[model samples]
Target: MLKGILEGCVLKVIFDNETYGYEISQKLQEHGFQGISEGTIYPLLLRMEKNGLIEATYKASVLGPRRKYFTITGKGKGELEDFLTVYKEMERAVHHLFAQRKPEADSEENTGFGEPEWEG
Candidate 1:
């Protein structure tokens, strides 16, 4: 589950802008995903490229090293859309599960620990 979520996040980051491995890891960390290593990201990137969700090209970097910049494919955009749809539904369900409900005001029975008391 977390892997899929991370993959979606990676796709989203690439969708926003083309970036290389280290930059992508930094962005993920900056966005509150701490402890994500380059090792993890690189493999995922390779997998996504192989799966046709993304395409990578070598570009000259200012730091004097050739960087593999990743861009989302048309298929990736479609996958991202599908992820958004599923994510929204999951978000709604989680919100609904945690949402507080107002208690009955006119009940005469004692409510124990915030639970409605059963009349025997």
Candidate 2:
């Protein structure tokens, strides 16, 4: 199943400027996402627009139906900022949790005779 949370994250990421869902999905795939189906993204886009988090404008598509482009609304911008803050803090905390730290040194080893081993 697709992660709805990541879908919203991707939407906000693209909604930072005008963009379409297909392009957004392709970018998401390129940006290390997997199992992100159009089924998952299209509905979320609709929901966000319904909630006034975004606005959609249609553009002509030569090969198919007109394409709809979405942009972040002021409300979406506020939400994106809040989401970005929380996401960054969580990312930093996770990084710290997963980060490796140097061990305390013994007096004999502390004279820059050798380097500390690194991991993670």
Best by lDDT: 1
lDDT of 2 by residue, 20-113 (tens): 8888887778777776666768888888899888889999998999999998888888777877787788779978764534454333343523
Candidate 1 at 33: error in angstroms?
Answer: 0.6
- RMSD list, candidates in order: 5.9, 6.8
What local distance difference test score does each model get? 0.87, 0.74
lDDT of 1 by residue, 8-117 (tens): 99999999999889988899999999999888888889999999999999999886889999999999999999998998899899787655344553343443224446
Point out the worst 10-residue segment of candidate 1 by lDDT: 105-114
What's the lDDT of the predicted structure labeled candidate 1?
0.87
- Total backbone clashes of candidate 1, pairs 3 or more residues apart or in separate chains: 0
Off by over 4 Å in 1: 100-120
Q: lDDT score, residue 38, model 1?
A: 83
